[model samples]
Target: MARGKTQMRRIENATSRQVTFFKRRNGLLKKAFELSVLCDAEVAVLIFSTRGKLYEFSSKSIKETIERYKRHKKDIQAKNPPVEQNKQHLQQEMASLMENIEHLESSKRKLSGEDLGSCTTEELLELEQQLERSISSIRTRKIQVFRQHVEQLKEKGTALAVENAMLRNKLSLQQERGSNKEKATVPSADISEVSDVETDLFIGPPETSRKRAL
Candidate 1:
């Protein structure tokens, strides 16, 4: 036969309640003593009777044990702060970050020439000076970039000039060689390609030509 399971609830009869409390309280005290003695553990227990009686047990002096417990609890709490404290800290940090963001946004708006209606004369002057400084820096950078470009162009121009000179020298040499070949082949036909005529015909300015024509 299965034994009936005892329900774990208050015994309604006053005499039964007192008896149960006395029995359980002594059992708990005995367990605490055994745990401390057998396991080398610091144990404490507290029980209250219905008639306002206190039953307490501790491996050492109860005051000292409680103080030690308080110290250990403090150390544990210090190592791992409560969730509420961490939450509050995060909230404060977020608030500070939001404030900084707002300040930066306001500054950006001011710099962009927006939200100027609330600015004082002194603030506006400061902004103007800041803008002037910024513009000066931009102009300096532009000049620097322009000078670099100019230097690059000058280098390219020099390179082109040197190339042109080399080409001219080569062309001159080729022309001399061609002329010598032509002279050896046909001395009578010593014809050469020239850009200008070397005659005594002085072709002056257009006005002089017109005068001479007149």
Candidate 2:
């Protein structure tokens, strides 16, 4: 009959677990020894029992193996240089960010008009000068914007004046072309009435225009 497969699980009983650990440790040490002798390969194994007992097997000095492992790790790290550079860059960025945050906090306190009680007279004067310069800059910008707006209004006014002159010239040309015919077809009083209506429609009184502008 074939033997049943052993279930892979923790042995529940303390005595059973201890026995298993002892057997497995011995088996592992024997395997390491055989592997080193038969294959002529370096081998190292380490095990720690639940009771804090240590078991180890090494084809050569364990210290030599550990040092080799450490050197191998360093070689791998040296081969990948970007990892260390990126780590240092990230550290520098974090430090810079922290410094920027502190500066911003200090500026915020100054802007809020706080933490000035301990300031020296020279520092206070410097802060006052900075504020004055800022206000002057703001006022200069405001004046520039106002001038731009006025210039835009003047451009629009010039365009309107040119359009009005063109319209007047067109009206005069039409009037000159039809003057004789209009006189023959209409009475003098009716001509005057039409002229008054045209004037009122095309050209409002100057005082009214001025009031509206204001």
Candidate 3:
């Protein structure tokens, strides 16, 4: 028996819906294959059941058909690029576009505002919490920067301490050398004292007369 005419609507009965889906799916695929064979033309069909199962058919490879479709779209666009030429009509479209843009902008502005009159209490609290978190993050970054600065200063102090210690050691060594030189050139007693006075007076060797006097 032939099937009766069916209403154009969702089939509420699960079994009937499933049977219909199977029958229609097979029929569509058969018709697609027949068309491809008869016309010597590429054909591709993609179907999805209500349950989300996929069915696909292509005379040539699906990828090739998709690539050919894309090339055709591009060639058509290149041949006749759509343009809005009439200024008044364009202005009317622009005015409509501007109205939509303004409406969206106003909505964005309203959402960004702090006025909680129209917003739910939960949303307001969430916004406030986010702001607090942002502030906390900023403060944490600030503290980290300060800590880095302090560490840099501490490193500089350590370097300066080492340099100061080296300078003090050099000064002490120079002072010790001066004291030793003064002690090594001490004067002898009596007439040697007189030669010593002469040697102290002059940096050269003691005079022969002074040595005889000693």
Candidate 4:
């Protein structure tokens, strides 16, 4: 005859519940032993009855199995750590960034002449003096740079003037040499004319010479 499936629930009778506990405990231990031996695996199982009786099974020493479990849990936690600590660290970094951003914004507002209502009279005076000092420094540096630029220009002008003088002197010397050459040519032509005239006078008029002899 086919029997119906037994309903899985707490047994109401004390004796029946105790009998079920014993049977289930023995079956569980037998299954664990078979799994370890067949698969060559390390196995551990623990059971506690309602009356606080402890039952356990282990392929090796229960203490060794417990230690191994603890080590495996630690390794898993190290590899995939809890999110709460990372969340806290990120929150702290976000708060610090927000504070820095706010500080920078406040400084920017002050520099732009906004948010002045919060400043005391002394702080205003100090800010004014600091601005004045910055302006003075900037103006002084500008003037120094201008002076340096002007000095450079003056040096350049002086060098150009000296170069111009040298060019003019060289041109004047060339012109003088050219003029001297022209004058030397003219003198040579005059000397040739004078020589011709003297020769004619010395050997001229044979009739005049015969008259003087007679």
Candidate 5:
């Protein structure tokens, strides 16, 4: 004879509930082991009971599997090099160039300050030419730096504008969602749950009932 099916309600007796939990847990673990063995597959299972007990199973060393997954991820990232590595390399080169440029400018300032007024007219003219050339070079570099700064500011401004638009859209969406949820949770206008509450507070009751209650 077939046993009767259990009802879909919480078990009233503690003993029966415990027995059921034990039987089911063992059956589930057995099935998982059988699946791993039959399919020759790696599997990990973690179970937590209502009593705060933990159960775990793994077809392979869990740590080894996780490490293998990380290795695969690293390999995939290594395959794509142009955009990331090239950008980083270019940035590093630019920074080094800027540093060397600052050092050279400092040295030039020191050289300009050294006294050469007692020198010959020919030497003076040569020095003047050198000074002009240095000034021209400095002016060119300043222009380049200014242009780069302007371009960077423009890029930053554009990014900020995009971010602000996204935030505004997100805020608008959140407000709309909140309004919809409020409407759903509220009772219908026809139902009027608060109408009686308002009346009880403001309206005078029958005189006889009031006197009797008092």
Candidate 6:
């Protein structure tokens, strides 16, 4: 059967932990040296113990390796610049925006008659004039709207009156027609009178009839 894998955890015994540290440090140094020699590369390693003991490895002078590493980092950073300049620009823009906002807020407050203790006579007069102009403009707009509303109401009233008159006329005409129809449907009495002359037996003789006719 395969052996179980060793669990990677801290050594409970202080002596064992120190021994493990020494062994790992030696192994790491040996690997660093081999990598630098075989690959012809610069290498550096630094390690510190819990008790403040220092351990290090460098293919060349440790100072030279540190300086070279710093230069390489600087080159990489130069290749892709940081956003410090952009951040500064954004901060300046934000500050300017905030200043404008504050200025607008102060102006609004002053217009509302708040914080007026610092106003000079000229400023007060100017503000009053501005308010007058604004009120005049508002009143003018309101008057125009009211006039328009009145005109609309007048038009609606006129239209309603005309409709009412037409309805009344139609009703009157319908009643008149109905009355005429009823009159036509009823019968009327004849008012002719008879003559009052007498027609007695006058068939005696042509001479008598002629005398009577005369």
Ten contiguous residues with the weakest lDDT in model 5: 194-203
User: Can you tell me which runs of candidate 6 are displaced by over 4 Å?
Assistant: 1-14, 22-47, 50-115, 188-214
Higher-scoring candidate on TM-score, 3 or 5: 3
Candidate 6, run of 10 with poorest lDDT: 188-197
Please provide, for model 3 over 1-214, each residue's C-alpha lDDT reduced to its tens digit, 9 standing for 90 to 100.
9988989999999999999889998999999999999988789999988778999999989999999999999898788665644566788999999999997776566556734577777867876787789789999999999999999999999999999999999999999999998877775434465653443343455575567557
Ordered list by TM-score, greatest first: 1, 2, 4, 6, 3, 5
lDDT tens digits by residue: candidate 5, 85-169: 8899999999999999997775565457654555678866776788899899999999999999999999999999999999999
Alpha-carbon runs more than 4 Å astray in model 1: 1-19, 147-214
Pick the TM-score winner: 1
How would the candidate models be sorted by lDDT, starting from the highest?
6, 4, 1, 2, 3, 5
lDDT of 6: 0.90
lDDT of 1: 0.90
**Candidate 6 Cα deviation (angstroms), residue 127:** 0.6
Please identify which of the two predictions, 2 or 4, would achieve the higher lDDT against the true structure: 4
Score every model by TM-score: 0.62, 0.53, 0.41, 0.52, 0.37, 0.49
Q: Candidate 4 residues 1-214, lDDT tens each?
A: 9998878988899999999899989999999999999999999999999999999999999999999989999998899777997799889999999999998898778767899899999878887887899899999999999999999999999999999999999999999999999988998888887773323343558888667556
In angstroms, the error of model 1 at 176 is 14
lDDT, each prediction = 0.90, 0.87, 0.84, 0.90, 0.82, 0.90
Model 6, 1-214: lDDT tens digits are 9988867998899999999899999999999999999999999999999999899999888999999889999998888666996788889999999999998998789899999999899989998999999999999999999999999999999999999999999999999999999887655422223544556668688788768877
Tens-digit lDDT track of model 1 for 32-145: 999999999998887777778888999988898889989999999999999999999999999999999999999899999999999999999999999999999999999999
Candidate 2 lands at a TM-score of 0.53
Off by over 4 Å in 4: 1-84, 188-214
> Clash number for every model?
0, 0, 0, 0, 0, 0
